[model samples]
Target: MDEALELGEYLPQSFANLNEQTYLDFLWSALRTNYEAERYEFASLAFHLLYMSFVSFSIWQIRLARPGQFAMAMVGFRSEEEGSLLDCESPFKFYDRLKESQIFRFLKLIGCNNEQVGEFAKFVRRRNKIAHPTGTVFFNDQAAIDEEIASMMKEVRNIEAHMQPVIRELYHRFLRDSADPEEREYTVLGDEITANFVHKNYMSAADIAFCQGFDIDALSGEPLHDAMKDLHDALVALYPAEGDVEEAA
Candidate 1:
């Protein structure tokens, strides 16, 4: 079996062991509290629902972004023609390259395969439908929409549970396998410190750039901190550890 597959196989079991009841209870409580606050119970429910929906989407983006980086790293080159072999040459091609990459195949070993990708894409689409003003009237008995959201959340949690170990292993491998130890150490340390800053302080992108020693106002013209706050928060939440607790205290 390929190394990626072997690495990823334990994800399903990890996912299976997760107590989803905790998440369900949290969602229910959040929705119920919102309903109690205002007489417009449906609107309140919808608002909380919307919050959950966005949270789910944010989680998916983080999950995919890291893996996508790892996958890209494994591909070992970046050419238009080379990218085309994986069906991703065009800048417009979002799904094609992800579907055909060697990393995707490796991810399959641990069961973090394309099946999960399809579901995550669907989650993003449904969130957009609800969030966008498309003139369609939304009702409280939107059972189908709610079901889709719940299913997507379940899958997101499953993917997260499974990928943690693999991610750790990949990180170690990257550090150990780098040809230039000094550059590798710097890169790894930068990644670690950036992750730490985002997790502990929920810093803005500007703050992140500053922490990394970049010029404050040069790159994107606008203040990137606010825009990146949510992303930083989500990543920190996902990878919380003993140090995070100590820092919080």
Candidate 2:
């Protein structure tokens, strides 16, 4: 959070060895680095990644929870010959297809409070204004930037807390239903659940950072070593082994 903090606190040495820098590194650098002269860019990048992850992964959670009719279409399927079954033009296009009405319906079915859905809509509107500016002044000063970032973080944390129990219960049901001897065909559903439900969705600290334009190598330094360590611990806590879905069998 400090303007001059070093990445040594968050990354590990092996981060340097990654073949190609990824969106994860981009976000990690933005969140962990305090580029003094680039404070505005750093704050914006960190906030954007956090907001983006919340929206996309929230939808991803829905796709995981409701594998019924529409959710299946959203999650799509990949085959050796057929390729992408859903034919999404782009990520934003995909989001448009999911839309608020669809997302709210999914949330209601999953027992999410109506108030939370309203808050989510408000947040999306705010994100739209930020992502596509029309003379909107985002931050007036360093203090304001920090305050806004903190506020967004609070919202993100609240959403995560609300989702945790719901997702857990749904997953338990999926596992239980999949394991019924009379429901062996449901095993494919389990496969779809596991294949589509990325574990990274559960661990915010380890969620991969993604953006449109950024140079990966130019962003690396000794500081990233510590951030990577923190991420590793987060992922380990979420899943100690690869036996997650299969173990439910």
Best by TM-score: 2
Off by over 4 Å in 1: 1-109, 112-148, 174-248
Which residues of candidate 2, in runs, are more than 4 Å off?
2-21, 31-38, 69-93, 96-105, 132-136, 170-249
Find the 10 residues in a row with the least total lDDT in model 2.
205-214
lDDT of each: 0.38, 0.43
Q: Hey, what RMSD does candidate 2 come out at?
A: 14.9
**Model 1 lDDT, full chain set:** 0.38
- In model 2, what are the clashing residue pairs, if there are any? 7-223, 8-223, 10-226, 10-227, 11-224, 11-225, 11-226, 11-227, 11-228, 12-225
> Which prediction has the highest lDDT against the true structure?
2
Q: Write the per-residue lDDT of candidate 2 for residues 125-167, one digit (tens) a residue.
A: 6655666646765654667666656665655555555555545
- TM-scores for candidates 1 onward, in order: 0.33, 0.48
Query: Residue 45 in model 2: shift from native, Å?
Result: 5.2
After aligning candidate 2 to the native by TM-score, how far in Å is the CA of 151 from where it should be?
Answer: 2.2
